[model samples]
Target: MARFFVSSDHIEYDDAGCAKNVLIKGTDVRHIKDVLRMSVGDTVTLCDSCGNEYVCSISDICNDFITTSVISAARCGSEPRIAIVLCQGIAKGEKMDFIIQKNVELGLNEIIPVLTEHTVVKFANAKDAEKKQIRWQRISEEAAKQCGRGVVPIVGMPDSYKNVIDRITSDDDTSTTLYIMPYENETDRTLKTVLYENKDFLNEGGSIKRICVFIGPEGGFSKKETEYAVSKGFTTVTLGKRILRTETAGMATVAAIRYEIGD
Candidate 1:
């Protein structure tokens, strides 16, 4: 079955305000009608970005829209219970695009690109920043759709190294967030061992609220920056004996975590 995500407004209500049918509009009309060549009575999956999903059947297909009658509705099974946030050091060219796509497929909850001391790319103004953010977000959305993700992971505006550290380590933070930074210099604390010691697995099972992984640029994070991050409670861990590129580190860390705790 094909899957799509829509806003709450797409759901139609009965006289008593209960959901009756789903109204799919815009470009998807052509996708179902022409691209996929789906017809009435075909089954499709729809999710209202809030996480509830419906197994719907096409009842009518019009030129402007498609109507789907609800067959069964339930919480999306694909969404991970433990969220993962990737704080990536901005890579140049198509590298960033690859990172965005792979991370979304790995079930990341959010991705933040950061500029560090060795960053190769620089923006002259806010306009450049906004445009890049939009493009990256679109990549994330498309990847989510392609991978059958229940929700598209966020690709946030680029931030500075200091800003990202502060953003994740604040007391006003409602969600339980744990930080992991992979450093080549560190040989003692492997990511696997650190996660096992720091995370819950016995009483509550291997349940993590959120895991934030930081991957520095090609030159890697400065010693001062790594020390400051450690001072702010970020754990410095190792991937292994070998070194990984800026793009490879985030995906590797996320995949390992998902293997450990993700259902």
Candidate 2:
């Protein structure tokens, strides 16, 4: 069935206090009626974007949009077991878009773009930053839907390397049990070692709830940048002996985390 996101206010019901109708508006309406050619009595799924999925039957069709009467409300299909926030150094071209989309599919909870010392491409002004942010946000939303994510992952405004350090440390020190930064020079330190060193992280609970992964850009983080991260209490780990590309590093880290944590 087709799927679309709706607001809580759009949920209407019958005397039984069950959701029976939902009215779609704006572009959603146009997409449904004009694009999809869905007719009255057709079935579709309207989600609240807050993890609730309502199975609905189309009740009416109009020039503006279509209305659907809810059949049932249930949990969305794909929600990860744990939360992971990826703080990635911004890469050039559409690479960032590809990362955000795949990472969301891989069940990332948040994405933060960081400006590292070796970043090749830079946004010149505020206008450019705002535009890029908007684009990233749209990509996040589309990717969420495409992967049937319960909640949309945020593509936050880009931050400087320094600002990322300050915010994470100041915000909630206990939020992440392991703040990992994979370095090319850290040959002796492997992902397995990092997980083993922090095995106690899973002791308090049956599982660890959060982790912060720091990834570098094309030329990678400078020595000063890595030093700054270490100064902020981030544990430097190596993915392996081989140097990974900017795109490969973050995804590899995420996969390793999922495998180790059963997430």
- Top candidate on lDDT is 1
Going through the candidates in the order shown, the clash numbers are 0, 2
lDDT per residue for candidate 1 within 1-263, as digits (tens), equals: 88877778989878976667998887778988999999999999888877788889999999998999988788877898878889999998999999999989999999999999989989989999999999998899878888888887999999999998888887554246677899989999999898778656411444447778899999999999999999988899999988999889998999998886634
Runs with alpha carbons beyond 4 Å of true place in candidate 1: 15-18, 62-64, 201-208
Provide TM-scores for the models: 0.90, 0.89
State residue 116's C-alpha deviation in candidate 1, in Å.
1.2
Number of the top TM-score candidate: 1
Model 2 clash tally, residue pairs: 2
The weakest ten consecutive residues by lDDT in model 2 span 200-209
Q: Which regions in candidate 2 have their CA more than 4 angstroms from the true location?
A: 13-20, 63-65, 173-176, 203-207
Candidate 1, run of 10 with poorest lDDT: 199-208
